[model samples]
Target: MRTLRRSTRGRIGRIDSRDAKTGIGAAELPALAGGRIERVSVAREQDSVASRFAERIREEEELRLSPLAARSYPAVRVRPEEDCALRTPFQRDRDRIVHCKAFRRLTHKTQVFVAPRGDHYRTRLTHTLEVTTISRTVARALALNEDLVEAIGLGHDLGHPPFGHIGEEVLDSCLKERFGEDFRHYEQSLRIVDELERDGMGLNLTEPVRDGIVRHSSRAPLPETLEGRIVRVIDRVAYINHDIDDAVRAGLLREEELPREPIEVLGSSGSARIDSLVHDMVEHSATAGDIVQGPRAGPAMAALRDFMFEHVYLGPAVRAEHAKISSVIRRLFEHYVEHPEQLPRDLAGGDGTAAEDVASRVTDYLAGMTDRYCIRRYTELQVPQAFAR
Candidate 1:
């Protein structure tokens, strides 16, 4: 018979070796031994800590949240199976958005500039972070649900196609021409979380988070929750200021060239502008009991947005690049529609649906691609490369 021995590793009751001839089961050895076996309660301790922290957070929300703030205790969409012991619904939503493949793709997607030569230019992911920062600042000031606001901000642009709005426009045009369907990024964002993510399993996000994501664009209706509303406002605030900074960096616009009235009212620089806008938003929204900008600051920000559209967004240099990007997107879209089999297996439509369904799937797959990925795919399909010997 082999002598039984215990190893003094981090875990307790770990059998060091098996005695095959002894006919003793490893698990039964502890019970069989006259000696007492001690079990480490690590999992129990961790669960206790997590449960206590979660309870404390709930208590904090009940005590500290404003009357207008969204509460996490009773989420609108309850998925008992998906509920977390450690995180609130909104917190879970934020984590899901952060960990998602779409969010990861944002790192290489266009924000304002498409594949800018300089590394300092912001990508879609950086822009999302900035928006979340600005939204949380406002939400915290209002004593609102910062978690909900953050989730919305982080996910607002998840469906934006490569090459920024230009790519969106090209895809929309192709879809319209082929299937008479429109491709709106905000709508696509909702689709991403609801259906396209996690191998078609979706994120199972909360109602408020989904509402905020779909309505983050100014063109959409206002969100029901004040937390969502905060993100809706801050999304514009982040992009306008950051786009200005990028435009300046790209030598597309100078500080002096920016519209004087809006600059004077908002601020002279990007950081100053964001600070001013955030302060104005907090002050006005607090007073009105709704998320809004001050009388003066609102118009100034609008003017700034208009200025960007005319200069940085639709300017000659950007328009030139937009033409090239539009061509790539349009060609790829058309090629895929013509040869549906070329699409990845998932997008090739095994559902026995109409051609329109295949077209929609193609649009979803293409829209999710990053800027560099789209360019590379286009080059691979369209450009003739020499075959290696």
Candidate 2:
């Protein structure tokens, strides 16, 4: 009987030198001298649908997607992982963002209006969906990677705090005054995905998705990928038009009050304006080989944006609530600052950690709250139990 020997790797060694020369492993050797074959398999794994699915998507993307479009095959995650059987990297990223707890909290967070009584008003979650829809439409027209665009669009505003921009503004001010640091929703969004989510392990999202989320704002640096660029531009397009609809519905602005010249150049209604803008963007970006808007529609959109800021965004209607929102945020900030033990254990470092670190944790906790939750917590802290009930 042939004796079996173990290799240095703890695997079965070749039965003889002849098997090594032939490149055959011990598994294939026939039994001899009345010994049964062990049949230790040594062949490479066979190709199948599960193994080839992602590669097929990459090949299809190479054929149909724009030359400048980002590819998902070579996904760059902060931590490496195995490829999914069915979803491309960006598709997987979209799934992760959708499933995460932060994304769910968006439903109760403010968009333009803070806690509107009417159900039709857009919340942060709806805004995200709108941006993703518009971005996908533009991406499809441009032959860009729609999956990447969708992922970026969905994640771009995940960092926005409750009470809309008012909450963000107060939080920023509180941080600067108390800790000599500043806060921005975009930066916080990056931190959430990189360090805060999943009880501090983050989402482990791909590099492109993370980049698109943090750079979707015009105030931030431009994104590296064309898909991210699409989201950056479309976010404004989605918000400006939707905010107008919401404003009119809230009786804060009349459709006729819109700037005449810009209205004529773009369109009278929100849908018409979006259509004109999308068409202009498609034509201009195709020619420029980058996401851009034509002169007329570009200036028209900008004019509309300016008009919104003056009348709807920063105007009397919304500003009236500013003081109330500010008080809620500042009071909460001070309360947490004086009592770091109230922070979640994951965010709160050890007792020996720096005060600045604790302040940062407070910021994260507050920023993650929904609009109603923020107000509820504020009431619970400030109001007498009899009055609160």
Cα RMSD, model 1: 7.5
The Cα error of candidate 1 at residue 372, in Å, is 1.2
Over 1-389, each residue of candidate 2 has an lDDT whose tens digit, in order, gives 34465443334545643343445544354523345545433332223445667766877899999898898878899999987876888999999889888899999999989778798999999999999999999999999999999999988888898988888988999999999998899998888888887877888999999999999889899999999999999889989999999999999999999999989998899999999999999999997989999989999899999999999889998999999999999999999888887767777354324777877788888999998899899999989989999
Judged by whole-model lDDT over C-alpha atoms, candidate 2 comes out at 0.86
Where does the lowest 10-residue lDDT sum fall in candidate 1? 3-12
lDDT of predicted model 1: 0.84
lDDT string for model 1 (52-126, tens) is 655677778888999888888776663445458778888989999899999999999998787789989999999
**Pairs in clash, predicted candidate 2:** none
